[model samples]
Target: MNFIDLFAGASGMSEGFINAGFVPVSHIEMDKYACDSIRTRAVYHYLKENDKEDYYNDYLKGNISREELYEHAPKQILDSVLNIEINDKSIKSIFEKIDKRLGDKEIDLIIGGPPCQAYSILGRHQENIENDPRNKLYIQYGRFLKKYQPRAFVFENVPGLLSAQKGQHFKNLKTYFRKMGYEVYHDKLNSADYGVLQARKRIIIVGWRKDNDHGFPAIEKIKRKFTVNDCFQDLPKLKPGEALKVTPYSLNKNEYLEKYELRNGVDFVTQHIARPHNERDLNIYKTAIKKWNRERVRIKYPDLPSHLKTHKNESSFIDRFKVVDGKGVSHTVVAHIAKDGHHYIHPDIKQCRSISVREAARLQSFPDNFFFEGPRTAAFKQIGNAVPPLMASAIANKMREYLCQI
Candidate 1:
């Protein structure tokens, strides 16, 4: 199958589709860096090669930055980035020429969510969706979908799209899709239920051509629950601050610490990961855990597990680390919240560090092989913003099975 990706932040959906055997034809992205990352490949090859200083000097010594080498990049890299359909006409011209390389292949799937700040819960209260400049991105996506007329489409966003303004915005979106002659099926999915160790919930809407009589196929249930330990237990252990030579494991550590130790620039997650926690947060964790432990002892009911009670007790330490029940689901793995360690943290460790990038990616069910790029901030954002790969894989598998029968 052929596809186009828009608002392709790190190509999460694209990777999922590709793993499911679909070929991505084009992608549109506003962030040059993120575009650069996705443009490279499903993983960071440059980083892997860069570590081998000898290889860089022998083969890439005078070559332009990887971002500038797209014209000469291999077919695989070009498909991921060069065929970009952009907001700028000048850029679009460059992409048209690249499209010629595809010859007569037909595009089959159009997948992506637009710039989603407007649909984010934080953006709604601080910025009005109606007036928010970013809200119109959906219109842009709609225009792209109409022009491409791909047989199938997938739109994803924060759950805020459902309850934002009591559902008025969602209502309008539904009507708009109906007007386009597409059968749209949307629902909020918990990533944990689909194999992600975290409990991220997102609104995923799949639209199919009315003639197909088939929309998104059902996703298989996760075979078993995952936990923080299951995802990160194999990695080398570190006290709050550490780094490793493995590219992915290396990127997972706080960049700032890596920068400070290695003398390079770092991004938000790296800095947060590298930096030690302040006294206030440390104290809060201690207090919270103490209060929670006391409450757990006082409770007599067996229905409520002591592990789940961590959510109810706000004393402080409980927020840092809570036992993740093997039989239950996990909390959403948000980015850069390591400072607070509230979202996902080590259940056994008492340290200030939040789960590392590798840990978070694992919780998101990203394959250990899928590498990331940019500073710590970019890495964290990409991981946090992505559709859990395992979830997408399951969905894609089901869709493939159903389509074969058709």
Candidate 2:
């Protein structure tokens, strides 16, 4: 299967798509940091594909940073992303490049969602949400859809798209696609259905050129409740303010931990270090955990102890500083984690700090080998914004079987 990725973040849907045997024809992204992160993954795959993975092997052993890994990158991956800026002037040039790389090859699919901030319900609470420039990004997706005329396409976004502008936004989207003459099917899917340890819900809209029996993939719900311990127990523990660029991990007896272990070299635990926290925040975390342990209750915001109740707008922050119950799946990891990480408090009573970048990625079902490229905070943002590769993979697997038969 061949496809194109638009609004492609560092990980999530595209990672699973690639793992499911789809070849990425092009990746379009606006953020430079996110582009860097995607490029790092491209380089890693290039090295591994060409039997030159020793370069990345060295980096895994603490011999190089992510930047240095590219110095030894294969020409194929670099050229794949060479010139395709997303601008009015560059759209034509990008189309021409696609023609060159994908010459005479019908694009089997086009995949991606418009930026979701403008359509997110929580984000709409802001005054500027109505006319946010990003609200119009869906038109850009339309342009590509019309140009490629792929046999199939998958569009994904937050459920807010269903209710934006009193449902007008969603109505307009359906109208636009209907005019294109494709049969569209949309549904809200939970990540937990695919074994991701986070309760993230997103709307997936799949379209087919001609109607028959095919529709969106059927994803089965996971019976096991993937908990905090299942996702984070094996990684090295860290103290507040402690940071390490590289550290060894035990070849633990867990599925994920075992997949990431390095037998000959020191496979570093990347972006797993803790950030510094103020005394007030630290004390609040300690108190929250203690309250949960003694009362078997979650310490949500607005119910904070007197010393911790500082915000005047307490009602809006009711779920703020929330400590995830250790017995079940984590709450949805949002991009807000990059700002301060207060929402995703560690469930452990002793580790009075926020979950690290690696932990957040785990909740999103990102594989341990998938290294994120950026500052620590940027890494967290990318993880929070991803679609959970495991979930995406299940969808891709079903789509693959159906499309190949066609």
Candidate 3:
């Protein structure tokens, strides 16, 4: 089966569908860094397919530059990632690019959701959010469906989308997609139910052509027996303001890592680096860690000592300085993590810092070999915005089964 990814965003959904044996016709994304990341991932997949993963490993080892890695992969694979925004002015050009990559192969599915920030709960708190341009990006998504007429589509977004604009937006979206000749069904899915250590929840909207009798794909729920600590145990520890591009694993792979294939038999891991924190923030992190370790209670921002309190309004976002629960599934990782790490403090007090890029990616169920292409902040934004590949793979597998039957 083949698919086209829209608003691809680091190719997280693309990663899962590809892993489930679906071929990507094209990936449409606007962010340069994320497009680069997707291109790098494409290189990895191509190299792996041809038994040239040593080139990929060398890139991770910093022995090969990105340009050199791209040199080893086919130009067509790299060119398939279109770094263009989807809008009225650009949609026609975007369609031309996808049509070129697609050739005569029909798109089996169209996968992606518009940026969810506009429909997120926190975004709704903003003034005049109804006017936010992102709220209408779904119209762009519908355009793809109309143009390609794919057999099915998977639209993923935050649960708040169901209630955005007093449910009118969602109603309008369904009406638009239905008018495009798709039978749409949506449900709320949790990542933890799909083998992810993070308890992230998303609204999954699946649509198929009206002629197809098959309904929504039955994505099976997986019962995970491990905790977030299982995801962290094999990683090398880091302190404030430390980064290791290539480092040996500190411990042997445990069952969880091995079971999920998080550690892909790589001798070294990249981007296991921590952000530098000032003493004041470090103190707050220490306090938060101690509280969670001792009493399993998260420390609110207002609970901090007067000397450490920086923000004046303590009424809202009180639990701003939260710690990742090492013993259980983590809270939803959000793109706001790029702005600051206060909400994603590492559980181990020894680190006394926010979770590193690799750690955040691990929480999002990205494998160790999936190298993110950008600085730490940009990588965090991509990871936070992505759908966990584990959950996506499950959906992809079910979708594939449904598509095959038809």
Q: Who wins the lDDT comparison?
A: 3
* Structural similarity to truth (TM-score) of each candidate: 0.73, 0.92, 0.98
Decide which is better by TM-score, 1 or 2: 2
Instruction: Write model 2 residue lDDT over 224-249, tens digit each, in one string.
Output: 64466767876777777777556666
Q: Between 1 and 3, whose lDDT is larger?
A: 3
Task: Output the worst ten-in-a-row residue range by lDDT, candidate 3.
Answer: 211-220
Q: Total backbone clashes of model 1?
A: 9
lDDT of 1 by residue, 298-378 (tens): 112232345444255454333344433223455665544523454443443354345566666666666554446665557
Which of 2 and 3 is the better model by lDDT? Answer: 3
- lDDT of each residue in 309-394, candidate 3, tens digit only: 88799899898888999999999999999889999999999889999999999999999999888888999999999999999999
Give the winner by TM-score: 1 or 3: 3
How are the candidates ranked when ordered by lDDT, highest leading? 3, 2, 1
Which regions in candidate 3 have their CA more than 4 angstroms from the true location? Answer: none
